[model samples]
Target: MAMAVAAGCGGGSDSGDGDTVKIGLLASLSGTYEAVGTEQRKGFELYLDTHDNKLGGQKVELSVGDEGDGPPTAVPAATKLVKKDKVDVLTGIVANGSYKAVLPLVEQAKIPLVSSNGRPEVKNVDRLWHTAFLSDEPGAAIAEHVKEEVDGPVYAIGPDYQGGYDELRGFTETFKKAGGKLANPDGKTKWTPFPKTTNFMPYFADIAKSGAKAVYCFYAGKAAIDFAKQYAQSDVADLPLYTAFVTEGSVLPAQGKAAKGIYSVLNYSADLDNEANRKFVADWSAKHDTPPTTYAMASYDAASVLDKAIAEASKGGKEVTPDTINKAIDGLGKIESPRGSWEFGKTHSPVQKWYLRQVRPDGKQLANVMVQDLATLGD
Candidate 1:
């Protein structure tokens, strides 16, 4: 609905000018995913601030555009960033639909999109790279664990969209393969009508009647908060909850007591005990009151990837063009990230470790505590 652009001191052309490299950030700055967009922007800016606003040893000029919620808003914003701003590279699409919508535009323009959030399955990935995991990865990573932990069948549910379909499929397919069963009627994953289905009481009641031992689902932003709060008061509140994205840092504080004891699977958590994460948390804490979410971590990693790619592309007097950057990205062996070291897989997403986390009390506040490493997953 609203579009905002900020330009730095640089030319608005993709000529690979040695002085500055222009980057476009398309995010949901308004609508349902606004919180995620804010975190994504902050994360990328933090990387720039620490690196002296440079990527690949070149000063950077950033152009930001609001992707809103879906294709309608995202396509227009992306067109402007590519056609008008002439960004050398693009980054920061929060929603899967937005990412899918702008794929053709980026591919046609021959610009690399270093996405910082979940993406749907796609065949041509020559110009697409994601710092975030594939949409189904989190569920897939935790499926075996959930299957072993629960004695009976698990109920799967999520928003009715491409993202939800991928997420639930990851769990159901893996769970069934691992000799697990679904408790939903006729062995189907329940689908809620997405952003439209705010009240989840009906779904909870269905879960109770299905005789499930545990529940697996995915929801983010406001939907996640609403689900957590309402689930706490539902008849099935005592059932074990297993999920991805529902209890992330962005919504955990708002979910509060309702989110406690919920188990989640993700690639990064603030409590991860690693040198990169320690520095990342300390640096992030200096500027933010709340802990950084995976949205922030993934976006921050996107910058790290670009930093290396740009520098590699600029080697031997070569111009830092999109083609060069895309090639450079393919050769970046491993990225040192807040989530630990990971490299781009065949799918152009991260081949990395996944962790099992539980919402627990951290001193006075609740946080997603890293329980243990679940599995290493990717393409």
Candidate 2:
């Protein structure tokens, strides 16, 4: 496909030298996480559409790469974006592995890398901004809740990857600190399926017989869908299920009835009470024919960050360059986000609110209803 070019003029628009701020988006457009990648892209596009496709008075161009779900494909795609496409800025990662692979290139180029979705294990990097939550924050938040609510051991499971391992560590460490014990402290109950796992019956059977009070899991995209459906159909369906990133946004639309009553932790919810969230939900639905997912929310926030930085960089008719944009973001304080107001922390990841939500019916659609706002639970 051709590069997505948004041309318009106003305020500090790209004018002299025929400059355009090209944003390179890396996502798994055709892999298991396609739903997630699509939602993120939609969110960024929605922001541009509402702003008439202009950032800081300059026109914007989005170049996309189908980075699949891992780094082997992602590194090359990101390399092409930076080396050949010569994009001015980079964003829109959907997986941790892909983010790790492409980060060195961005750091070497000194181009601002705004991560829209991937929540890597590392924190604090120069010229890199994480508009999304870290991989561990939601897991830690859930662990805190699990400690207070669940009376017995909490079992854990995740896909076997960097994201999975990071999320588990987040939950386990925090849960232990809160005096919670693992179902199998020897790590016997912890399960890690291959990345492309579709059949979850075997795992569910193990979980059913594991004699755990509740289960803590980290799964996203297609894997999340399959696991939720299989768990709901299994004998252990009645047990309390808690997870991070498993029951929100694009995952829910596909999960449908199986998603009901699942307690999850996230920064944004469809039913989060706030003016910004209310307006964002309505606007996104009107444009996309669906409610905005957390992935979408992150992408929208990334776009907003870019818009603010670009506007600052273009001040006094100054040419917008990578260095200028980086400086603008570095100086940025709190961003008024749809999830809520948040600011970049010392680690460049968002220090934002974490909501404990339960999936329930809201009229004809399933929505994540906020149980409580566990405010600002990130590094």
Candidate 3:
């Protein structure tokens, strides 16, 4: 909803005469996914403000697009960011749906666009990439820990989108591999149109009839907490819960007691003790009014990687082209992220360990309990 614009043309040039390297932040600034976009934008802006809006001595100009207004609307915003604004890099496309809709423009222009968070695999089409997530990689993490102690009547639920399908597939594939059977048919993956069906009782009714001992799902932002409440109030209240990409600072507060026994497989758990995470969490809490989400943490890392690449490239006297930037990213190899040590995989996604977490009401505040040390799946 907020557009902050800057022209880096007059800034001092450390990267040779400082051609203002413009970066585009495309996301659903307004729509069903606006909550995610606002958080992502805040995270990106926080990094810029921390760095004084400079990357490699080149003024970083951010042009944000509202991708949720629909694909037709997104195309024009993409054009303005790419052609009119003349940005050097693209950094966001909030949800998996918007990312998928906007790829062609970035790919055609051969621009290196990073993401603010875990973008779906379908979002990538060669030059268009995200450092924050690995689609095939996360499948194993979700399956790895959930498979350990859960089995019998394992029900899966998610929206009928690619992201939903992917999460369901990742959890189910790993569950079955771990000797767990899908309480419902393998074909019952589709959940239906989202944002329209606010009441999840009917869905719960179906899952209850299926007789699942455990339930796993992938829902982000407000929808995640919505499902958590529904899951808690479901007739199958006795079932243990296993879900990936849940239990964050943002979602946990809304989830309240409904999330007491729910387990999550994620890249970052707020209670992590590592020095990097401790510092990140502390610094973030001090800086922002709201607690940072998993996406916010990943967005910070993405900015760090991009800024590192630009600085390294400038030091080597290389022009800041998309190809050169991507090469630097590919060569970044291993990084000490807030989550832990992560490296770029063959699929151009981050290969990192997933943490197993449990939600517990700590003194009237639900906090994530870091349980398993780590779990990972792909190359």
C-alpha lDDT score of every prediction, in listed order: 0.88, 0.82, 0.69
Q: Put down candidate 3 lDDT per residue, 40-82, tens digits, no spaces.
A: 7777777777777876555676778777744766778888888
Off by over 4 Å in 1: 1-18
Better of 1 and 3 by TM-score: 1
Clashing pairs in 2: 12-57, 13-57, 13-58, 14-58
Quote each prediction's TM-score. Answer: 0.95, 0.94, 0.89
User: Tens digits of per-residue lDDT for model 1 on 1-379?
Assistant: 1122232223335443335578999998888888889899989988888887788777787889999988999999999999987888899998888888899999888889999999999998988999998998899999999989999999999999888898889889999999999999989899999789899999999899999999999998899999999999999999999999999867888998999999999999898878988988999999999999999999999999999988888888666677888888999988888898999999999999999999999999999999999999986
Q: Compute the lDDT of residue 153 as modeled in candidate 2.
A: 86
Ranked by lDDT from best down, the candidates are: 1, 2, 3
TM-score of candidate 3 against the unseen true structure: 0.89
lDDT of prediction 3: 0.69
Query: Considering summed lDDT, which 10 consecutive residues are worst modelled in model 3?
Result: 6-15
